[model samples]
Target chain A: MAIPDNQGGKRAADVIVTALEARITSGELENDKPLPPERDLMEEFGTSRTVVREAISSLANRGLIELRPRFRPIVRKPDYGTLLSATGTIVRYLLNEPGGVQNLYQSRVFIERGLVRDAALNATKENISDLKAALLANEKALDHSEEFFRTDIAFHGVLYRIGNNPIFPAMHEGFTSWLSPNWARMTRSDDHNRSVYLDHKAIYDAILERDPARAEEALIAHLSAAWSYVEETF
Target chain B: MAIPDNQGGKRAADVIVTALEARITSGELENDKPLPPERDLMEEFGTSRTVVREAISSLANRGLIELRPRFRPIVRKPDYGTLLSATGTIVRYLLNEPGGVQNLYQSRVFIERGLVRDAALNATKENISDLKAALLANEKALDHSEEFFRTDIAFHGVLYRIGNNPIFPAMHEGFTSWLSPNWARMTRSDDHNRSVYLDHKAIYDAILERDPARAEEALIAHLSAAWSYVEETF
Candidate 1:
């Protein structure tokens, strides 16, 4: 983790970033709340004006906080895009290491299991209806694997929406998109018809019944089998 | 979830970004791999050069890939800084909503328990030794809570390193820092001393014995109690 050096050969920016990051993360400074003015911060942290500006800029670039024109820096809410970018970075880093893919998938399964359970508990009527629509799309595309895959994802998207935690679905979707293309090619050789139908049906039944424990178990079983197939073949 | 617009007015850049993002996450492009030249990708996707360039720059800025001085853009490995940014964003967002603090603490417990479990299983002899050293540091801190807190983090950090996944520790570190400042107030109650020692000892014992199941159980119990306290107080 060799961090790049500062341009002006000063450590003030680095020190301020670290201190401010700790402050923000530790819940000392609440989200959507403003920090002290630049001048105030500079004086308080004993840093130059440039250091203060650079620290704020770095934070903004990372999407951690927003810097308004006149207002002080404030914490920002993360949307799906920020979540995915972060997921992409973590997954990519893990994938580059030796024997990282399997471990990455393992963590994905852990996260997805929890996500679906929450979705089972929290999903609204609208989300359930949308999930049903996506399932229908899946059934209609029985012969079209690509459409089936898209609809399958759309179904999960609904599941994610139902989960009600914005972070869970966004992160899950990012990893799924990363992992799915490989599985898609693998699925082509197998008898995808019966397994896909049954697995997805089990999930739908659990969701419709509002059985979170069952839903989570079914999801784990479904993905475990699917992932096992990928592991065996690919 | 309103995304920032693509620099160009049209939606083509957005489409290209989506497609390229999928490819990058799927490991189709791979870390440090060169992206196709602008002209080549444009012809393949039937999108304009501007669309492709915008997509690439967007991806780079988001930390998905990097734009080099010459030749094609390269897909770089994801790093801790990026994960921290994302985790911080998510935590901050959670903190903004009503009952958000409780929810954030719940998530913290969930993530940290899993991390400790994984860390226990993956820890090496050297990791254990390092962790022991941090524990000694903690003991020496006595009445100095700040030093104890810092060393306490080091103890867990060593465990994160043991998990054999770089991203886990990185993400954990990000969350730890994000949550640290508030921790002092949270941990300063009448019962803090006894509870912290016992819980820390339980985790330490499990790891020392290499009992993954025990380690996980202890971690969950510890976190569950802590979460209850935070929820009630914070």
Candidate 2:
């Protein structure tokens, strides 16, 4: 493959990235293979070690390659870390920039409605048991209160697991972490904890009963109640 | 701020990144302020120029800092590109791994349903006109064919504009591009074109009528039809 010479506004690393990107997407660099070593890449590209390293780092940052220090970089299946970071950053953007925290929370409602719908449609005996286990944990931990939050997050995560999609779990965790601190500040009352547990129990019962519409209804009610709390507190 | 010592597998760059991450997240490094110059950072961190640069790049990758060559790094608002890179990477992961393509399409359906519902509820005359302009352009450009796809994608993007949140558009564009090649193969027939146009028209009319439930119904129908075609073909 032909590698282009660096041009205006293009760093040497950028040029290497363009060349590597083409090779990777064109199937020349097989996913099973490691990239050429830094010394070889430096010699081949006639660039400094730092330039070659940066080029590889750029590819890694974009989730195109996996890098381990002192090892040849491996061609990688893009992973969830990229998704998690990106999602957390976007939530921060909505909170700090013009979109307001309400927009972020509303988006979460849309996503959870989809998740619970999928869980209800796809839930098996094992999935139901998993949901019950999480809820049972939540019920037992309420005395600890701090532990209430952990089980609550895990219950929603279990819903994603029933749907058998990695994407949902990644997104659920990201959205939950982003909203957690604000949610804690807004809903610290005893009444809030009781209702939160009851709302989750409703979601659990609906999923166990194999009713997607009911599950969505319970989730929407839960979100609506939470939204009211946030709006009122803020 | 106390900069932690580099230990175990942690490189000097990693040490600097940890220090910077703390200061940035704590708001000690104000968003309006650029980081200290490379020479200053190098002196402070007792690391090489390459290490300092890499640390800065790490912060930039996380959207904590913005890097411009020939300038000190500026603190930045986390932006859509980070989210886009993450999401596109995750989609790539699904395509390459046992995760399969179904997850990506299902995720898109979930997201679009939300976007269209928002568009219907929040749309104004300007938003409606934008949707109409895109639809009209699609109708007029059927012969160009490739332009047909562009307009189709643009039409959905316009829907996100009505919701007044930047996240949906970024996601729609990313997901559309990822699915474009597969969608092209599935819907190359003239029958596909006519139906696709009609489906979009249904969506536009629903939004113009300010009926969100109807808008969602049209979108779900459109997606189900498209999903069936993909499933049958691939």
Candidate 3:
């Protein structure tokens, strides 16, 4: 492979990163396989070992390769989980900024509003049944705060799953994980859990009735109440 | 500061990273100041130079600090730009995957739907004027496709800015940057630009009239039409 020369102020390492990234993303490098050994890359790119290592490190940072001690970096095909995981550190940092928590919470409310409306309009029979099962699980776990939180997320997961787009579920998971620090600080009780469960029930019932407006209203009410708990801790 | 022991199978570098990250995030380490010299960190952490360097690299990857070629790493207080920039690589990778573009587009639509509604319901007079300014600039740029695109994004940006939340504007910018590749590939003409400008005008008109439902409907219509153009290149 011909390595593009550094031009227009692009560094050698950047050129190598772009080239290798293209190959990896195009599946030419193949998943789970080791990238070219460091020496070979140096030889092919006509660069020093340092440049090759720099390129490899950059690629690893981009989630294109897995770097392990004493092992060659392995190619990783991009997946939804990897994509979302890449945002974790950034999200954590943002969560600490002023109004960060409220902004993120509002974003979630906006997103889930769309998801629930989509569920009401387009969910399959299996989707509704899955939501019902999740609601039941949530009801059963009401006395257990930790379990209640888990099932609460699972119930919301169904709304995401209804879209059959992997991005939605991954995004939902990201939101839950990122906002969880705040969630953890909130005082939980059976009464609080019961109120949340009732909100879910109302949302689910509206979805079952195919009433998008009502489903959206219930979702907003639920998230708004939940935000109040988080706000108290803040 | 006492360094935590590696009792939980955490690497030496990880422990150092965690310790330094806490210092930086907690503002113990001031932004724009160089972190302690390598020798100092090595002594303080009771680790080798390699471990200190490793920890520094990890911190840089998480965007907590900047590492120049010869200078000690400078502390960087987290900002919205840094947070969103970190998602750029992952978003690019996902845009290459099946249905990725469409999924991201749908997300933008969902987000903008909420934004336009918010603009309609809550926009102050100044917000309305800013949007009208953006709309007028967009009209003038219609004959220049590239300029028109910029003004188009600027118009949409007003919707994001209405909420006075940094996160929304950051998100809007992220979506534009991430999706611009697809938009670039679409055919553009004065006629096409005119249609998009009209859509923006409709959205602006609804916001000016304080009609949330109409604004939302216009937004959905506009975004749906825009998606068809992007979908064609698929």
Give the winner by lDDT.
3
**Backbone clashes, candidate 3:** 0
For candidate 2, write residues A2-103 as lDDT tens digits. Answer: 111122556678788778876776668888589878899899999999998888776766667766666678885445544554355445645765456776
Which candidate, 1 or 2, would have the higher DockQ against the true structure? 2
Expressed as tens digits, the lDDT of each residue in B1-234 for candidate 3 is 011112354668778988998898889999999999989999998998877876776677667887665667899876766656555666778888788888888878878987888788889999999999999999999999889988999999888898888878887877888888898988898788999999999999999999988999999999999988988887
> lDDT per residue, candidate 1, A12-122, as tens digits?
665787777777766776878987688998899887776686677656655667654455678754554555543454555556556566666766766666566656767
After superposing candidate 2 on the true structure, give the runs of residues whose Cα lies further than 4 Å from its correct spot.
A1-48, A63-77, A86-94, A98-100, A118-126, A184-190, A206-214, A228-234, B1-47, B59-77, B86-94, B98-100, B117-130, B184-190, B206-217, B227-234
- Candidates sorted by lDDT, descending order? 3, 2, 1
Q: All candidates' lDDT scores?
A: 0.66, 0.74, 0.83
* Segments in model 1 whose C-alpha atoms lie over 4 Å from true places: A1-81, A85-103, A113-144, A154-164, A187-190, A200-221, A228-234, B1-78, B85-94, B97-100, B115-142, B158-162, B187-191, B204-217, B228-234
**lDDT, candidate 2, B18-128, per-residue tens:** 888767766788875999888998999888999998887766655567666566778754455445544554465456554456778878877787677767878778888
Task: Determine which window of 10 residues in candidate 3 chain B has minimal summed lDDT.
Answer: B1-10
Candidates 1 and 3 compared: the better one by TM-score is: 3
Clashes of 1: 3
lDDT of 2: 0.74
Question: Which 10-residue window of candidate 3 chain A scores lowest in summed lDDT?
Answer: A1-10
Q: How does chain A of candidate 3 score by TM-score against the true chain A?
A: 0.89
Which docking class does model 3 fall in? acceptable
